[model samples]
Target: MKMTRFLATGVSVALVLAIPNIVTAKPEVQGQVDFFGGDGVLRSAEFDARIDNSGAAEGRMIFIDPSAAAESDPDGPGEAVAGAQGLLIDADFDCLVVTNNRAVMSGVIVDSNTPERIGRRILVTVEDNGRGRRSPPRRLTWGIYPNQARNWTPTDGELGFDPGAGTSWLASDAEREDDVPVPSNRSEAVSCDSFPPGSHTLVDIGRDDGNIRVRP
Candidate 1:
């Protein structure tokens, strides 16, 4: 009888130790960005991101805006807008994996000409109502904005900022007055398939050359 009791206690301890591993298993997701331009044509951009079970995320996104004169004037002087790449650091993802299917990432936009030139730090918030489910088709909404108080310029890196000033560039009147469509109306939604748990592969969708894909 004592031998059986000892064996039962050992099994209980083993089960207790294994429970944490199962409970701590991280939930991750991967997806890309596809949105319509001002001309109403769908444009695709590449983005891959993942969140650990602890709600920390590390990922990258490449933004490519199609040339406005591509179709109308093939030999025009204006070229397609250069691509901008952003790196995701230790951004918060708890809200996404927990209650709300929303995640916000903060990172810097690196310069295209010189890879080391950090142009500006920005915030990107994404929300998916379908939670990556396939049947309903996951709908993703994205918003982008500057996170710093300084203004961005092509020549001068980042300029005009007062540390002690109470003004915020994100909420400044100048930003609101700007008529640029990309920054002003940054929010857009696109349908995508669900990403299953433990899956770590790239999924591509949309047009041929301007396609978007998410990679592990």
Candidate 2:
């Protein structure tokens, strides 16, 4: 009887150890980002993300265009001409996560010619479908003009475009005037390769080139 009881206790302990830990957290998501410039240009990037149950997100954004011209004045021709200098951006970005599928990112732009200027800032907001699979981000906006100061501040006022001002690129005049939803039948699903290849540089996350990491 003593030996049988001991075996039963051992079996119970083994069963407890066999039970797996349940993870109630949301699964990680991966997608592409496309920024529409005021110059009628669209630049692409890659973003892999993990959002917590509370809707907070953490991710990395890798801009495609490493070297592009930085426009200081989007409307003024003289400052625009003078400010047309090659801005080499450091593509890898650690983002500031916002709840409800939004993020703000900033990175340094290396310009040997202009040593006084700082870097650039980008804002991305996407439509959320709770519990359903997340679609590709809808709005990827950036500063059309570069910041003169060392600290990064957005140039929304200088660019004459503000989403909060009801002048967003995604907002139509009717939607702005009436605050009504615009009729659309467009899918948000997009692949990184679907964007124009020449517009930006591409990063292969699978390679060991140190652009991205699974654990990091």
Global Cα RMSD, each model: 12.8, 13.5
Model 2 CA lDDT for position 152: 35
> lDDT tens string, model 1, 1-216?
999999999999999999998777653445566765345655554555565655566556555444322222235556533433322322222222222444444445554332322444434444443423342233333333333353432332353664434432333355566653333322222111112222222222223223222222
For residue 51, give model 1's deviation from the true position in Å.
5.8
Please give the CA lDDT of all the candidate structures.
0.41, 0.41
Model 1 misplaced regions, further than 4 Å: 22-29, 33-38, 46-57, 67-99, 111-118, 129-135, 147-216
What root-mean-square deviation over C-alphas does model 2 reach? Answer: 13.5
Query: Can you write out model 2's per-residue Cα lDDT over 54-80, one digit (the tens) per residue?
Result: 755455544454347655564776564
Candidate 2 deviant stretches above 4 angstroms: 1-30, 34-40, 48-60, 64-88, 91-95, 110-118, 127-137, 144-216
